[model samples]
Target: MGTEKKEIVGMIRGCIKTVTCGQKLDLNHKSQNDVVKPLYTKLAYVLGLRVSPFHRRQGIGFKLVKMMEEWFRQNGAEYSYIATENDNQASVNLFTGKCGYSEFRTPSILVNPVYAHRVNVSRRVTVIKLEPVDAETLYRIRFSTTEFFPRDIDSVLNNKLSLGTFVAVPRGSCYGSGSGSWPGSAKFLEYPPESWAVLSVWNCKDSFLLEVRGASRLRRVVAKTTRVVDKTLPFLKLPSIPSVFEPFGLHFMYGIGGEGPRAVKMVKSLCAHAHNLAKAGGCGVVAAEVAGEDPLRRGIPHWKVLSCDEDLWCIKRLGDDYSDGVVGDWTKSPPGVSIFVDPREF
Candidate 1:
């Protein structure tokens, strides 16, 4: 077997930048680079598309995307997708207009910094660390309501950097205000299930790092001032700037779900759990990408509007089977299609 990393795009004239290239994705494994994108089956993922500064306005990018799509089909991939920030119109046009791809889903990636103090200080329910097998069971119970849900549960639970899985269980059999029961917790009395909320964490410190550089000195000054203010008023929730010298501790939280009032409490407890884990591991942030329409998205803590980052998911399907069991319609345009946000894609 060939061990060489495949390279499709040649180096630009006197420059090291590759014109374009992508990778074959398998959801059963973690990304070699740790950006948490997961697919249900095999697919082609276009990544790190770049053109030299001297190579502007040419058809090279379009050609590269087309060739990569062909490579996907030839390799038995049923679909291909690319993820990019929503503001990048140039890349968007190249994929949707030139390469026959369409807008599939727009999801937001949210980041929450873990401080020494607990952000989710819920006292009613206690979070219990779960074994992988039990965690998979809890995930499946909540999976049906989600789109783009991971098909391989083991990949998520057993990934090398996975910290742990957790469930929020009532502190005691009898529930009360002191017991941490909320109005929504009553639903479980009528229709009982194993637990209230479920969540898992992945450590992406080695697989990922964030970069933030200001174009001008004024912006840098303003950022520094904000950091100073954040320290002065610890509860201000200012965004943390990425340090060039230090890789931010990044842990990804995924498969988050809960029912009703208990769900809210669970979200808090789970976040607290994640924060404690991140703190112990020297991680600075815990993040997750979720569908904008998902109610759970509203629960995960973030810096109001500032911490919400949107990314466009573009997909092109190659097969004709759009039966009930299958995921999406190959015949229709990508917009308005149901999407499952895999946290691994963060």
Candidate 2:
């Protein structure tokens, strides 16, 4: 029941960085804070929040968030968090200042354009579609311990929006061959290939219609020009970003990670595979959100201009268990290997 404010790594609204952490907070700059990871605790994420235009400046949003937090506390949730764009100052202030939810993470939302030409998957890499059960088992084994992983992965993998889960591995290394029961996590990880990557694809085309408004004329010109040039000259392989000016669909790839030297190769191939899938489905973009420090960020292909380099996440503790009197705040502890960006939140 203690409402203490503390800064971690992600996003929160404030009076802005000039508001004081002993330094000016710059949304454009990446945070250098150590990873403050989870210990498999109970938590809830806030999403789909909106207020009527008539409710503006009436402290309605703040009250609503407080009420939700009370509900979370009543339900025994140990923590609650909110995610928003870094440039959204109003949202930042509402949470970080008024609501006492300090910054938690600065993950980037990586967005890749779906070009007219298909992105090629490497020949040496074999892409395999996974059964939902098998995919669930694998996720639990690997990512269940990571941040932002859903409470129930089975529901996510089985949801209609989830296209399927896929794994990229060196060719001739198919593990799930026979029609036997899923062998659980240990066996799946047992004798794994030297290099491998796994990810799930979620179709966001139907749920959200996103458009980029008020773009500078030059940016618009560049986006349009790139599309035209790419379409007109198929072999040129231009680095054209997606045209987000109009409403567009997005395919979100989540639970991404890999091992071994060629793991990066597998991830890139999987991204290309995802790009091809999105293009065929008429989605304008293939997207993902990864912790800024996750090496996977370097592997996933995306356009810099089209992506949000520093989207923020803010978290509040429902109780005082998050702190240890002897060692300072647990929020400043080292983070996990990678953050599990649950597409369900989007």
Query: Which digits, one per residue and each the tens of the lDDT, describe model 1 over residues 60-170?
Result: 887666677666666666667788888899989888888888887777788776664335456667666766766666555445334555566666687777788876766
Worst 10 residues of 2 by lDDT: 14-23
Which candidate wins on TM-score?
2
Model 1 ranges with Cα > 4 A deviation? 1-42, 116-120, 174-195, 215-246, 321-339
lDDT winner = 2
Residue ranges of candidate 2 with Cα displaced over 4 Å: 1-39, 52-55, 172-188, 216-222, 320-332
| lDDT of candidate 2 over 33-77, digit per residue (tens) | 533322445565677457766556787788778777777777666
Candidate models: Cα lDDT each: 0.61, 0.75
Error of 2 at 158 (Å): 0.6
Residue pairs with backbone atoms closer than 3 Å in model 2 (clashes): 10-104, 10-105, 11-313, 13-92, 13-93, 14-92, 14-93, 17-25, 35-334, 35-335
Clashing pairs in 1: 36-344, 36-345, 37-344, 37-345, 124-180, 147-340, 148-340
What TM-score does model 2 achieve against the real structure?
Answer: 0.80
